[model samples]
Target: MSTGSGAPSAPAPNSHHDTVSDDATATASARGTTPGIAAGPAAPPRKGTFSSLRIRNYRLFATGQMVSNTGTWMQRIAQDWLVLSLTGSSAAVGITTALQFLPMLLFGLYGGVIADRFPKRKLLLLTQSAMGLTGLTLAGLTLSGQVEVWHVYLVALLLGLATVVDNPARQAFVSEMVGQDDLRNAVSLNSANFQSARLIGPAVAGVLITAFGSGWAFLFNGLSFIAPLTGLLMMRTAELHKVDRVPRSKGQLREGLRYVSQRPDLIWPIVLVGFIGTFGFNFPIWLTAFVYHVFHQGAGTYALFNGLMAAGSLIGALLAARRAGSRLRLLVGAAMLFGALEITAALAPSFWLFAALLAPIGMVGLTINVTANSSVQMATDPLMRGRVMSLFMMVFMGGTPLGAPVVGWVTDAFGARIGFLAGGVISLTAAGLIGLVLARVGGLRLKIDLRRGHQHLTFVPRAPGAAAPSGEKALAPAA
Candidate 1:
């Protein structure tokens, strides 16, 4: 479904900060994703894995997001299934998906510009309310037996419009909540929360879809916005880590683009994800085909598949939350594994075998998401974060508009296996190429050891005196 913004412009809340610890700076220098802010004294480590939650504002935000993200997942399942049922064509499902993300493709950067200038909390309130209204409208039409394919299309477009702002704002807002010190942890935990909801949302959506109809799921999703709206209202603005707003300007968008282009640490990861997102991450298309066509399963099994994937994603996100830094090598490695797993899953001989592979796919997928997200946010200047993240997300989700329909057609004509396999090959190739380029930029080369009980693989400096800026400047030092 889609949502729109009828709310008139209001002044936005301020932005956030960028800082790194000495240790994190050294590690970043070695990895090529440093924030480029000079190293400060080493900061004490966070007391626990959930250190970000120690901040009251972040805790409130997290609790609220957990509810809404689940709702969002529910809508995704119901919307896709509903479209497939109505049209009886996976390509139609693809079209629905494309429409939903097309706005991100077309207008995502503008959303980022708005996000930088506005108060995120207020922006979220507006966006969330609009999204909830769209859900309610869709629910009402479906429940009243007046809904049509056209109605779904309209709602999806509207929703995408709202998301163009909501997504960039919400992502940049995280750093504002906990500051750079706990930014990575917060980002990881946010993924865990989304996946946690993924597990529950699909199951619930499955049950609701089967028993009543998709309408109830939509209705529940509409109401789910209440939690976040309440949370946004309750947050103490004074407690937020506020930064100066970017004054309105004509060339701001170009500035964000230029910023990313100059930084290899930021650009390569974004480029890697763009390729991966455009091809490999067509799960909605792939999974729907597997369930409806290949496995001949009902809604319950589809939900089960999603839940299993969610389980793995949750594990990966939690693991990421515990670490103090994000490495380009780690991100590259995860992307490779994700692609390999997808190829394997596509060729699985049995339904159960196919299902079993999904969990790991989900795991590595979350790893890529968390790693790339934190790394980019860390390396960006605070003033440009909204625009940078918009670019990151646009390259990621926006690519769906280009990929989903093509993947859907491939599924329809060549069979789901061909479509899935093609995506995997592209993903793996992209990851490998990006990894090599990043390694070269870092002035490092892969080292291999043939002996038993020795380290089998590592990256070493190409020359003793070589400076790997990508490693040294990729991320902020741990703070």
Candidate 2:
């Protein structure tokens, strides 16, 4: 929707190491010191929600990504329509989606390692170029009337391979561009950029598909890569804030795994994401099925639903940008709300009513995504950012391969409504369980208070040695 490797030798917990300068910078930033900047009088308050745009590199990156992300979404819509046109089967669509994400499930961890070991800008140049070429090849094949489902499958796999590297590099690179102080805002704005592109891309793809054919949409997407490539080339390398490159080590992957294992703040969110992503995030499959089978609609109607959802997502992202930090409570509440709305939408009797529900559904979904992403990035060590983010993405996006096919099959066999219901149930259950786990493990107790004739439930930290609940330690703040 758009929404690891084999076991190695275990490394000692908390034994992860990094360059002294990088470690010092991270520590200073945690203490409110601007890393690499001379101390001076208090800076003026940031002006607006888009404060991260003040940085030259991030501005360039965001502008380029806006264009590229639109193209990416265009291709996504075109590809799905093409598969449906070729096979007329929802299960085929699911298989295609699964193949696209299979590499992430297999080698995403290795991609994180690569991101950590190399210059992020250099790696991004290579990956982005490779993705562009893949897009062009697909456009040519489709235009020449030689395209087949297998061709689509092959191209999707290639793109997925590129993304395995691109995703982690892009995520970790944000720290270098804006430093820690604005990371949450930067991450939120990135989501806003993506969703805004989503608002434009699918609608355009729908028109292109209906007016000409899927080939033109693919061709447009192929050419759209130029914007990101140009932006990357134009970035001033000297102005970039550089993090330390991780040195080669035998047990580094194991070390990343061990590090994540020990942090409840990190692990629980990842686990919750894994559940929701696997079951809840199959929008392409579910939405397409609902449009074609349930509503008896065409390409325009499918695009409309997506556009509406993106509109909500954009609003949610902008709201997140106005905030200074991420919290577990926000993540949990958003997930539950997203799941509940999805369930309600699934039961809608009319297409218009169903479409109306998608807006709020998109809003809560984006809220969960931004909160989870920012919290993880902010709480992680700089040296471990790539590996940690790779793991987070692996759980979030990689679960698609495992879930899409099954969800597609369920939709085909049962109905689109049941498929949606299944996803919502899984998401709701995951949020409830994870929330309770976090509360118990973090020494938080839920207290119900009556005020102004209203009852409220609040989680408050308990007193020391006050019979703390037996569980893992609460997630430590970013080190």
Candidate 3:
């Protein structure tokens, strides 16, 4: 089933070759292959957020990711717990996290070049195997009572190195599995899968750590790699929709940087994401502080908060799946809402009220995530997808190394409430500034009108020969 550019070219068509199914006929007609057949009506497109699940390859990929994501979250919780148990220092925990993401900031661009030159599937196999080994090594060290802070640090750095490559390859690999037709649905479903795992993994990790120890959680994560590795092996190669591989060449990394720099749509969202990611997405630091300092609670309460957020995130992902397209306005609005909600949660007087607000915070946060991811992917050229997505991931995830320490310092110096307030203020400010920039760059004119006792805001393109608005001009639309 696998067809590549290396495959022998098909023979020229002859009069005798006429076998074709009705579906094939319809496809050919749609493509203008047969002028007579093109006269007929076209078939309807499939609908639903789960439409991507109908693809065998995507089904396998999602199924595997669900299991792997669970283990990933479990290890995340256990790692933090173990570090805290050993040192009782939040700053130590921040350093550990910063180490895990430091490689992405330093080497993520080079990883994109590798992804563009190589086959993603093959590259993933190697990276995933390396990560699994790191997990097993950590598990062994923990179980033997020989795990030192240095050992954890070393393993975290190693895992981050593997992730530098794996993240980009995996992000760009979705196109090959389901093609553009189902890409948005696939991305939303992937988010849902991760969020669902979030709901289960931390809760399970909490139980394991309470009963057996943190060692068991790490051990389980080590074994969880089996599912994804198996799924990769079983995919039908021929069915994959292969994209053109960029030839090995000099300056490719710089070329990617130049490409993104010129495109306002790509760069602006990326900038917003960088700010929000650096400031707003420090959930580990924030959540841990809330549980230990504000609520005076244990690991169980911490797990419950995460579980509630994950539940909200899952719902948001599903709602995103039902939508057909991504919009820049939606991303900006969601970012603003997410920030506002976080501020509200920070000021909540009661524990249950704070927990209640977390659901909406999770919802808006996922909405922004899904919208930005899909919009960027849909806008980029196929040849540049790997590099562009790598840049996006680098900005989104790499910022953690820079921001976590600052947030942790703020928490330690001030209180956890001040930390939340700082994050919210940064998030809201980013959204507002980015919104105005996008409006100006896109030549969009905003109007306010009163209807049914409510004020409505709308954006419209300027008309030709009309008096120009102060800040409006013709500009390219974001794809």
Off by over 4 Å in 2: 1-47, 453-455, 462-479
Could you give candidate 1's per-residue lDDT for residues 1-479 as a string of tens digits?
Answer: 00001211111212122223567657756756433432322433544567778888888888988898899888989998888888878888888888999999999999999999998889999999999999999999999989889899999999999999999999988877877667777888899899999999999999999999999999999999998899889988898998778999899998889877767667888999999998998887889899999999888888899999999999998888876567678889999999999999989999989999999999999999988887777667778889989999999999999999999999999988988999999999999998888777665678899899988987666655344453333322211
Better of 1 and 3 by lDDT: 1
What does candidate 2's lDDT look like per residue over 294-314, in tens digits?
Answer: 999998888898999999999
Q: Over the full model, what C-alpha lDDT does candidate 3 score relative to the true structure?
A: 0.79
State TM-scores per candidate: 0.90, 0.89, 0.88
* Per-residue lDDT of model 3, residues 1-479, tens digit only: 00011111221212111233568556655665432122222322436768888889889988988888898888888888788778766666777888899899999998888888899999989988888888888899999999988888898899999999998899889889988777777888888998999999999999998888888888888888888888899999999997999999998898889877766667888898898888998888888888888998877787888888999999998887777666678888889988898888888899999999888888888888888888777667778878888899899889989998899889878988889889999999999889888776655556688787765976544442222232221112231
Instruction: In candidate 2, list every pair of residues with a backbone clash.
Output: none
* lDDT of all predictions: 0.82, 0.82, 0.79
lDDT of 1 at 264: 68
How well does model 2 score by local distance difference test? 0.82
All-Cα superposition RMSD per candidate: 6.4, 7.2, 8.9
Superior by lDDT: candidate 2 or candidate 3: 2
